[model samples]
Target: MVSRAHPHGDDDIRLLGDDSFEQSDEKDNLISFDDTSGLRHRGPSSSHKKPLSAARSVSPSSAQDSPKGPVVAVFVVVFDAKQGNRIEWSHTVDGSVDIGGVEYKALPSGAHTVSSDSLTFKIGSYYGVAYFRTETDKSSARGAVFRSCGLLGRRLEDIVGFRTVLQSELSQGKHSTGDYHVLEDLVGGRSDFVDNAFTPVMERVNKSEIELMHDNKIVRDFCTLLGADIFRLWKCVLLRKRILILGTPPFADLCHIAHLCSLIGNYDISSPLRPDYNLLLYVDLNDIDKLRQSKTFVACTSELIYQLKNDCYDVLIMKNQLHIQDPALQRTCLTSAMEKENFSELMHDYNLRSSIMHVDSGRFDATEFVGGYFTALNEKILSAFHAADCTAEQTIADSALEDLSLNPASDVPFLQALANMHCPSIRVQRQPLCPQCHLC
Candidate 1:
């Protein structure tokens, strides 16, 4: 579950089966790495993909579905110096056609000082990517192909292994001899694409459809949530801004809870409109403006802390009183019994100290873990900013909401309690003391 913030950059370079970019280039090199043994998944869903009739030419006429053929679909993503995911490009290539011959080489790669344009993979052939980079300019790109792990006689790992080799062998200049695989020997030029040998079925991709289709697969799926599985990833994100409440048994009342929060005039977790102020921030899904503008929220994560680390966020790091599972694993490592109680009070204290904003995590019962924080902030947000805005915007928003508008019952027991207090602030604060001896 290593995040973009991995501490060992040099080590990553080495592990990616490449030496320092500063090393001299070799005329022919090879690094044979097959991760099929490491693959944990065993199936692919093919019901949605359209099948291609032939492997040589991609048929674009299957307009009802995304392009599908014998070729693998390669997705490209560029990263920053710290290796954070950035811009992306997607293309389709037959396994025998070579990733470079498809389309991307004619674009930004030639313009930028591409450090290395190589292929890497995750979980056998379920995912295959062609990575390219420009070190001096801090530009990087990747081409990814997706197929069911076991579909159309394609064993997941076998496809990944084949595609990786194709992308490598297709490089015009032979890779230098090193601690790497000499892929050129295995590759045959475009002429070898005939005879239906080592070909793939992939559909053509157009520029207009790329964003709605591949951006998430590259940016969010591959880049930010790499170590995490997609199921929980969807849940953590489905309710983007709200303090997402999740439980191990899948929280049967998720929608109901959201409804309740809305009725109480609290924020809705699943609402689509972007928040003026966000409380949960996904690594690649969010931008810099959202992070800097956030208030009260400190970096509070009980899970996947490493994934979010060292990406150059300058906010205060609040102390977490509890620990939880990494979000990438399919299931939570912790059970409900171990969950901390009175979480609300702790969140309130943390917010008072940090002036909080957003929270993002994939731990089991994530909502419960941060429920206290959300609850405390719920009142504070309503009482402070929302109260005024709601009243002002109600007239213009809708006539339906006018009947069910905000009405803060000014007379409450808490008001009497605060009025009876002698402090200038509305909330009453007591000095911290040891409960056992009643002294600090």
Candidate 2:
């Protein structure tokens, strides 16, 4: 999606500069946005009363049940022509955790001078969701606008819900030291600032409470966009190869793809090959230095600058196509006959549920399916290695393989390669049934 005011159509675009900043008159009256509806409501002091159901408190039990609730911090980041992205103002839940470090992830890398975009990215242990907005500063000498800021939290949806309300407040010129108390309260697990409409349903994904909640549409779109290549991409992430995702503005989808890619490995495993979600929502030339030095990470960029940098990443995914620098990694996309059959079966089941089961039934979740596939795959590979003891003569029992959606012929060779890469001390003999020639 393009920015409402600054639409980016060109491959190469310029960004706003420091000359664009001219202090504008601040409006005293604050307007609060209704999260449930797009309508605007009077500020908190308005005598108008909301419905009883409209103003439910965020009880302590609700906050305790899931630690992901309440945002961590809110930041106002602005891009300077001279210094690049910088934080303008920030407020934390408890006034702890340094918000200055978030300067990089707060705005898209190589963002246009006047475009707007939203992204979700990881900063250390916290996840940040940001809305980048740029408007024409008519009073400025350059007529350029500046502002790209974010909301931080443990839950993606929660931060997003608050982003709408916060953006509304910012647009109204209510950005004062005192104006941030509502934001601080929201981050502190107080939802009284906004109505019940603002609350996002904190539903736990089936099978695991630890797994972060994801939008079905986002997962489905990513899977549909990649089609069969999703398997190859999954393997790339599983191997923790450096991956770069290039996309256009309103990089919300790309951010989701990067996030889902980051979840490839089992959390319990502490191997070097495990993929870490180093999700850089947007990147430009400034970010290239760090991206080059980084290990096994998945990052997204809207800047065309990366198109020239082939040496930096092992895999590049753009425009629904997956590209790999190494032919060996690319060849993994070729599926064996057994592997094809297994994928077909998984697809059939997925399609059946999509068509037969109603979405409201909650039985059909693409993220769950994809997540479960990887979880099972990780378990099977880990279990197989333990059972076989990395011996060339021992064959895995068919019963053990039955639990996996992938056939033995597909996972066995790949597992061996991964084992050899991560655990160099143990020579993982290839499973005889895999027949490497089939993959090549």
Candidate 3:
């Protein structure tokens, strides 16, 4: 004998055909999105028009006890640019309108629908039902089945469709990669880390709340027109800078290249602060004074220095003149100065000194002009110069003559050159006391 324990027994089953249900009952809990005209009538202003008799007839307690049927409330959370979540819409079972208070619970014993306002979803409908005897059993059984069926049937289709549309639209732009060669060239030869670094930054800019709000507001106003967010393009500018700074290229070389790029009327990268500028540099307080005094240097730092203080890791400013007293103002002036060709020359001379020093010119090496050489020379000359200046002229002359007598050979060239000028020679010996010079 086999015992059947089917929870949904055949004898207890009931099926309501699509068209057989009463019109009011079928539409009772359903939200009519199509009734846009009358929705304004359901607002607070309309409540005042109802008769007082109708208002007094329904008691608050009785109304509370009365079966308030399942409600469906749709919530859309728009995020800011920096926020990371991607969910555009989400819904729950029971069709309840208790949006702020209740947590959405998935039904285990009955079927339900989940819908989103996102343009991605086409079905606008979903079906989920409870199974198994216990809550845990029902959850486990439904979850395992839901993973395969619900995801593929509903979620995946919308996601894939949305992504396909996005990719297609993106492909239409100037930087698009619709061609196989373009994609292959971008991905095939790049290192793993280089490729991975870009993925998160791109995802961040694309899914930012700023972009979503802009898109939604535009959609609301214009009906069917779509526009790409310009903010996402800023990410490319940032990525280019990162590549220049951290790529295998030397730092000095990259800075020089950036400087040159600014000179030729080609530094535009689309920023709100400075729309047609490429690079910005910030000078430290200690170095400002020296930079200001030099004819070859100008402090042209940006007033936009404060913007970089928060989000960015490193900041570069290009300018013509920088003031030591005000680092912030100097940054701003620098942006204005960046358009000049001479700014590149100044930056090369000041910033790229180490790189320039090693290159051969056959003249005196610039390395000798560094602070260390002057410091060593100062230490050697200061004490001896002070002693000589303090001593009497006669005493100094006598000391010099005594040293010359002890090492007369060293004085021979001096004596001969003085003799050539017809200066007096005191004495000459056949066998000189000094090894090389006869006059001592």
Once model 1 is optimally superposed onto the true structure by TM-score, how far is the C-alpha of residue 16 displaced, in angstroms? 16
The residue-level lDDT of candidate 1 at 426 comes to 33
What are the per-model C-alpha RMSD values against the true structure? 19.7, 12.8, 34.7
In model 3, where do residues sit more than 4 Å from their true spots?
1-185, 190-320, 323-440
lDDT string for model 1 (1-440, tens) is 00011122222220111221222122110111122111111111111111111113323442212223222343333333343332233333334323221121111112132434332222212323333433332233333211111111122222322333444443422222221122221122122321233433221222233332222122211211122222222222222322322111001121122222222222333222322222221111122343444331112221222324433232211121122233322122111111112222333433333222223321122122223233333234233323333453322222221122211121122222322321223332233333663311
lDDT of each: 0.24, 0.55, 0.22
Strongest candidate by TM-score = 2
Whole-structure CA lDDT of model 2: 0.55
Residues 1-440, model 3: lDDT tens digits: 11111122123212211232222221221111122211000001111111100112223453343222111122222211222112222233233322221111111111111111111111122211111111112443233111000101111111121222223222343122222222222221121211222221122223344433332222121111101111111112222221111111111122222332222222122222221232321122222343333322111221223223322322232221111223432221222121122223322332244344336422221211211222222223222233444555311232232232212233233223322222122221112333443223
The CA lDDT at 19 in model 1 is 27
Better of 1 and 3 by lDDT: 1
Per-residue lDDT of 174 in model 3: 16
Candidate 3 lDDT at 134 equals: 12
**Which sections of candidate 1 miss by over 4 Å?**
1-128, 132-162, 170-235, 238-335, 338-440
Task: Report the error of model 2 at residue 261, Å.
Answer: 1.3
